[model samples]
Target: MGETSDDGRLGLFGAVSISVGGMIGGGVFAVLGVVATIAGAASWAAFTLASLVSLCVAYSYLKLNAMGDNRGGSVSQLEEYLDDASVAGMVGWTLLVGYVGAMAMYAYAFGSFSVALTPPSLVDAVPLGEGLLRPVFSVLAVVLFVVLNVLGARATGLSEEVLVVAKVAVLLAFGGLGLWYGVQQGSMEYGFEQIRSVTPVVMATAVSFVSFQGWQLLMYDQDSIRDVETTLPRAIYASILITILVDGLIAVVVTSLAAPDVIQQHPERALALAVEPVVGGIGFTVVAVAALFSTGSAINGTLFSAANFAKGMVGDGLLPDETGRASADGAPQRTVLLLGVVAAVFTAYGSLDAITSFGSLAFMSVFGAMCALAVSERDHESVHPLPPAVGAVGCAAFAVLLGVHLWNAERGTFWAVLLLAVAVHAVELLYFERESIVDGVEHAEDLLVPGSG
Candidate 1:
């Protein structure tokens, strides 16, 4: 592990890998199924729009990463941009809602796969329901991921790569199945327009936006990157581009091949329907099992990165010293335990509506804040090609969609959490942090010594 007086900055490639792991999960696999219902034949357009929108925010994050000089995402970055501890703590809460809630939803998703793999009769024998093995699998997945992460960052990265390959394979297979089914039915028209007519496409894009999340993982190890200026941008761009193409391929092919009626009739099983006519049971098993893991990984990765970054923020005097106390092996044991309990509580009460709603809102809010930061910064400060205005547009667009949805949004977790975060920060900033401000100053020197890793 890299080390310094404070912490080790991440390398460019490490940032990129983390971003890929986080972004490529639930947003692509589980989201596409839901989107297929709203978008029909135009699913590709929604995905395409989502991709463009993601880039705008990506620019915002790059700008934020460069300018405000914050390394941890949402929470730390918000403090840098707004210079308000209350807002920063709120950012932290929103982030917790997204990451922790995701873990719960994805855990339930894994249980769904368990039922898929076995017979309904066996599922009926279980406690939750006749067919809800997903919750069980979710807990197992969490335990497994936590263990891998505790082993160290390198272990988590290596294990995640294998999982990622499996995830992409599932997506490709889903597309091929849909394409084959569409061809057999003599109705093969694979294009983005069939589902997106630009206007309604906006809603679809907003939903798909979640699929491209996790780019902020770049900042988890702020001190770890060898060259943040060149490396961070490249990592964010490359990961987004790859994910966009993968999502597009799956969205278009599935919608085109599954047929509008089939998709609407069994939206959740659209991938299965596409494959039923071709590879039979094998294809069905592949998609169901793979999707379960893919989504689960998305949730798992988010929690892992956020917890690690929280430790960093505390180290920077941006948070209380209690947050920085870890075990000898450097595992933030208390933080992880707290995160795990939160995740499990959410998992036990898992609901897709809640997960997507809050995930979308909190995720976009962070991006919007980043855009505000990016735009406010002077150009002499950044090498970004896109202006802060562009980022702002992306940010505003996201906030509007979230506001409209918030009225009936099932994701009230973020708002509730936000209230708590504000209270916590108020207590700290108003009472506890002045003494640490000087400590923070002394620690700033530790950040200057390069190659400490």
Candidate 2:
């Protein structure tokens, strides 16, 4: 780990890596099929749209970070700005649920991609169907990562390089081969009319926003980064630009080279299937391995961070005190174990499409709310009016589109996640009613009394 004072040791390279690594995980491989089903040959356009929205969200985060020295993310923002403990608790719980859902999706992706590599003997030995084994494997992956986290295993720079570089290199290679194949086969012009509707385009953009989630990770490192004002924005812009180019190329290549039915049928393995036209059977192994690495690394990092996040929430009285308990090794073992179990259960029960949808909506809603808060505050002298305005409006629009997509396509999952969010907040209210009320009053007093904190 890089040592630093209150200010960070990370430079532009570190910031960019954080942005890219946070994104470009199981999301690209898993959500590609979903977007492909929605936008067909124009999936690249969906990515472009999502990139625009990500840029806007990044703007809001950067603006907020520029105004403060603290590194706390949404929870901090809600408490400091909104000054309402109930709101912060609700948003914090929602964010936690979203992270868990994403973790489940990553676990599911790991297991699904590992299917091709599973030994035939092992596969045959299973009494249940092949599809049934995925959940088991998914649960195992979550448990394994949880144990590793409890052991204080962290993704060092070398590990990050191996994980992020290898996956990006391989995916870029696939994109190159697929692009060449598309050009030679003249499939680029094969399906223009299929991109007729706006609803699907907006929906695809919203879901694919998950692929850009990591860009905001840099925001949390604000205190550490050198030249916070200039470096932060530059890194955010550059990382998003790189992601846009890479993801756009991959989307275009996949939609051009593969059949829509094939992608839809195997959304989790769509990239693997898309690569077959270029490199044949071995290509599947290549993409599948990349998926495993991507999802594995993502699970490790998110699991470690989520455990700490749970502890932070407990410190703020947002969660039950038991969640913040540490084991003998000084790990947030309780939260880690609980998160692993919840993620495992989600993997077993939830579909990728449903999980991705719920995660996307939760993140988008959080970003939108943050942007709205920034706009309402309007105290930051450095921030311009346009970016926050655009971010707030864009986030709201995309969130609505996402909601419509859920209502139209995954209505059952939509309602289930909705009730799940309410249930989470309901528990928060029942368990922490006094704290919530007290915190809210104190927050209001702090705002009114000026320097009371």
Candidate 3:
């Protein structure tokens, strides 16, 4: 339910759940293949490193929240302080781009997962080939998810509960089956240095760290929390801790049972393959179903947050008013649609590689902004486990990684980012700076809406 006041209502458990749902979304599936290709035997270690980095970022957010009343969360708050179209605004756009791409990929993945799990009879009934079905299914998946979102937060929350339960069960079953079968066949061994590789391991760890980025989503829903101070920090830390343990366990089981060759061969089939020997017919089905649910939620969360984020940009004058229009529930229904449409178009064109290249950089840039803003906002620094110094390091690391990502991956996409930044600046200069009386009045009215459950 939406909150009455401008404050949040999400409890500690709710905050943690939101992060968990966000982190496990499609990342768990897509990221697994990438990391396996990179790290091989050291995949688990890479994931662990990634988790630690995510936790570092989380701590930065906690400090930011503690510094002042930041009901606006990361991007919004950054937009407020940093020039909305300044480097700060570009950073927010970067993160939003990542969310947009992630949404598209997840929607596209729905069809691929169906093809892997659906029987031949169902495949034959389809007029299109498997390749064609993927884009069509992707578009359809986006539509269905949007409809569910429009139904309201309560329904989405219920869907999340079911999805989370099914996901956890499948992962656990897959892990158990992998451990048991591999051990029974004398193929299992306990080793100390599971991670020995260099660059590949580092890359895999980084990939896993990004996939677990959803913990920050809770901070956006500041108005939905019952107690911001207690819930926000606790929810973030707890969710990351759980993600670290669960992801490590999954990677370990998969790596031990199925080598880099197997995972890379059918990147989409790694987990299913890992448990097939032990769980046999049923286990494969279970794992596939679970993967579907997890990624689906991830996609949903991305869309959910992206729509509101765009409005945040608009409300702050970074985007157009049409993009910021809200439904009765105060949700940015139009922005959500815009993001979905953009993502669907990208999905339809098989632009995943290009999107991926730009997407990760965009996300990291915003993360750096969050850290940078945290450093700027906080006055009381402490020597606790997570402090401003750590956040400062986190910010620098994120920026450096973003630069490396931009320079190394795809020059075209990096150029595209530069162009995007210029366009953002032009918009800010032409429109955002000269806020109209109508827009400002409307924006103020938005905050005055009484929360009706």
How do all the candidates rank in terms of lDDT, highest first?
2, 3, 1
The per-model lDDT (C-alpha) reads 0.63, 0.77, 0.65
lDDT of 3 by residue, 353-427 (tens): 344434554556566557666666555654243454454465455445544555575466567656755664466
- Preferred candidate (lDDT higher): 1 or 3: 3
| Candidate 1: tens digits of C-alpha lDDT, residues 116-222 | 67787777788866234656666767776666666654434446556776676777766766766667777766544643355456655666666677776665655
lDDT tens readout by residue for model 2, 22-116: 67774477788888888887787888888887787787776776676555678877787767887888777877777787788888888888776
Model 3 gets an lDDT of 0.65
lDDT of 2: 0.77
**Poorly placed runs, candidate 3 (over 4 Å):** 1-8, 79-88, 121-128, 150-159, 189-194, 326-328, 351-357, 377-379, 382-453
What is the alpha-carbon RMSD of candidate 1 to the true structure? 9.3
What TM-score would every model get versus the actual structure?
0.77, 0.88, 0.81
- Between candidates 2 and 3, the one scoring higher on lDDT is 2
How close is each model in CA RMSD to the real structure?
9.3, 6.1, 8.7
